[model samples]
Target: MNSKSHVPFIRTVKISERSGKDTIKIRIAAFVLALTAGGLFILFLGYNPLELYGTIISGAFRSKMAFQATIRFMIPLLMSSLGVALAFKMRFWNIGAEGQIIVGAVCASYFALFHDNWPHFLLLIVMFAAGAIGGGLWGLIPAYFKSKYDTNETLFTLMLNYIALHIITYLRDGPWKDPGSSGFPKIARFTSNAQLDKVLGVHFGWIIALILLVLVFIYLKYTKHGYEISVVGESKSTAKYAGMNVKKIILRTMVISGGICGITGMIQAAGSDMTLASSVAGGVGFTAIIVSWLAYLNPFGILLVSFLFSVLEKGSSVMQSTYGLSTYFASVLQGIILFFILGCEFFIRYKFVLTKKGGK
Candidate 1:
C-alpha cells in the first residue's frame, strides 16, 4: 500500500504572523457574521431584526438614567477584568478573583460597620486599604502553594470561592447579623459616611476605575516588574537564567492582581450595594474572566469589552419588558454573538488548508 494514498484533504496550520490590521479585519467580519446570525434568529421569532437591535441599543442608552445603569454594571466588571488580566499576563490562572472579592468586601465591611463615627474620607480610604490587603492575601495563598509545591492553581482557587461564600453566610447568620432585622438573616447597611458619594450622578468608583486603568496600563507596559512578569510568562526557565526570582514574581504579581479585584468588592459594597452581602461579588469575578480574555488581556480593550457586555445585559432586560421576549431568548442572542466572537480568535492564530488530491 502506498502511504501517499492516505493523504488527508484538509489540515490546520499555525499562523506564524498576523498584522494588527488583519486581526482587526477578522474580528470585524466575525462581528458582522454574528449580527447576521442573530438577526436570522430574531426574524424566525416573528420580530424585526433591525428593530430588535435598535431596541437593544436604545435600551442601553436611550436616556441618562439608562446610560447610568449601564455604567453601573460596567464598573465592577471593568475593574475585575483589569485585575484578572494582570495574573493572566504572567501566565498565572488566578481563578480566585471571586473569593478575593468576597474576602475584601468582608474586610472593608468590618470598618464600615464598626467605625461609623470616623471622618468620611478617612474611613473610606481605610476601607479601601483593608479590602486591597485582604484580597491580596487571599490571592497570595494559591501563589505560595504553587511556588512551593506546584499545586494546581485553578482547582485551589475555585475551592476558595466556596469557602469565601460560606464565610459570608456565617457572618450574616451569626456574628454580623443585623439585630433589628426581625429574624431575617441580613447584614447592616453602611452609614452615610461609609457609603460612597456620587460624582455626576454615578458612584465615584468610576473615577477610581479609570485611575486604576491608567496605573495598570503603565505597570504592565513600562515598569521593570512588568518586564520580569513578561519573561516569566514566556519561559520561567529563561527568567531564572536571567536571575529573576520566579517565586517572588509570582507572589508579588498575584498580590497586585488580587488586590485590584478586592477593590471591586469594596466599590460594589460601598458604592452600589450599600452593604456587604453574600451576593456582594455578584458573579462579576467569573464574568470578568471572559471579559479579560475577550480583550486579550489589554486594559483598554477590557474597558471597551466590559462596556459592551454591560450594554447586552441591560438591554436584555429592556427586551424582556418592551418586546415581550423571554429572558432565555435574550440569552440565546448573547450566546450567539459571543460564540462568533470567540470563534474568530481561533482563525486569528491558525488557518485551515485544503490539500489537492494525490498531492504530497
Candidate 2:
C-alpha cells in the first residue's frame, strides 16, 4: 500500500494512501540537512567550502559557455523528466527510458546513414519520427507484457535497459563498426546535416524541450486522458468501476513516455553528439526518474529542478578546474541531495515513534 526509501531522514514527511498534509518547515529542515552533509564533505577535504559553493554558482552563470552547457544539460533532463512524470501520473513505472533513448538514437542514426539524399528538412523529420517510434515501441513492449499477461512492469522495464546495452555493444564492435576507426569503440561519424542546428548560440533542442514541457502541463491539467491516467494510477479497481479502460491508459501513457524519451535521445544524438552508441542516453533517463519523483510529477516543477541539476553539473566542471577537485566530486554532491530528497519522500509517507528513551 505504501513505499519507503532507506534514507536516514525518515521523519521529514508523512505520506499516506493519497495526499498527505505537509508544511514548508519540513522541506527547510531537509535542505539544512543536505547542506550540512555537503559542507562537511568539503571540510573533510580541507577545502574552503564557501569558495567551493561560490565557484559553482559563478561557473553556472558567469560565462557564455557555462550558460550554454547548463542549457544543453537541462534540455534532455527536462524532456526525460517530463516523460517520466507523465507515466508516473499513471503509476506506471517505465524504467526502460534509457533503453528507449538508445533505441531512438540507433533508429534515427541508421535511418540518416542509409537513406538517400532527401530534403534536409525531411531528414530531420525522419530522424525525429524514428526516435519517437523507437522509444514508443520499446515502451509499448512492457505495456504489452503487463496488460496481456499481468507481468510486473517495473521488472519488465528495468530488464529492457540491459537489452539496449547489449545491442549497443554488438553494434559498436560489429555491424555499425566503422572500418576507418579503431579502439575508441563508437559509431561512425554522421553527416553535417544530420546534426541539429543552433539558434542564437544555444541548441534548438532547448526550444523543443520547453515546448513539450508546456504541452505536457496542458495535457495533464486539462485533458480527459490525463484524468484517466490519474484515476488509473490511484486505483485500477476504481478506474475499471468508473468505466475507464485502465490497461489502455497504462499502455497509451507509456507509449507517450517512450516517445518523449526518444526525442531526448535525438537531442543528444543529432543536437549534441552527432553520432550514437552506448553513451546516447548519458544516464539522463535514470536521473530524470528522480527528477520526476522529486518534482512530484509536476511538469513546471520538473523545469525548475532540472535547471538545478544542470547548474550543479556545470558548476562541477568549475569545481574541478578551480579547486583541483575531481568531477566525481559533483556526483558525490548530487548523490547527497538525492539521498535527502528521497528520504524526505519516505518520511512524507511514514513515521517512526521513539517510545522509549532507548530510541528503538
Top candidate, metric lDDT: 1
How far residue 80's Cα lies from its native spot in candidate 2, in Å, is 0.6
Model 1, span 57-168: residue lDDT tens: 8999999999999999899999999999999988999988999999999999999999989999999999999999999999999999999999999999889889999999
Q: lDDT per prediction? A: 0.91, 0.84
Residue ranges of candidate 1 with Cα displaced over 4 Å: 1-5, 324-335
- Candidate 2 matches the true fold with a TM-score of 0.89
Candidate 2 segments exceeding 4 Å error: 1-22, 345-360
lDDT for predicted candidate 1 compared with the true structure: 0.91
lDDT of 2 at 164: 84
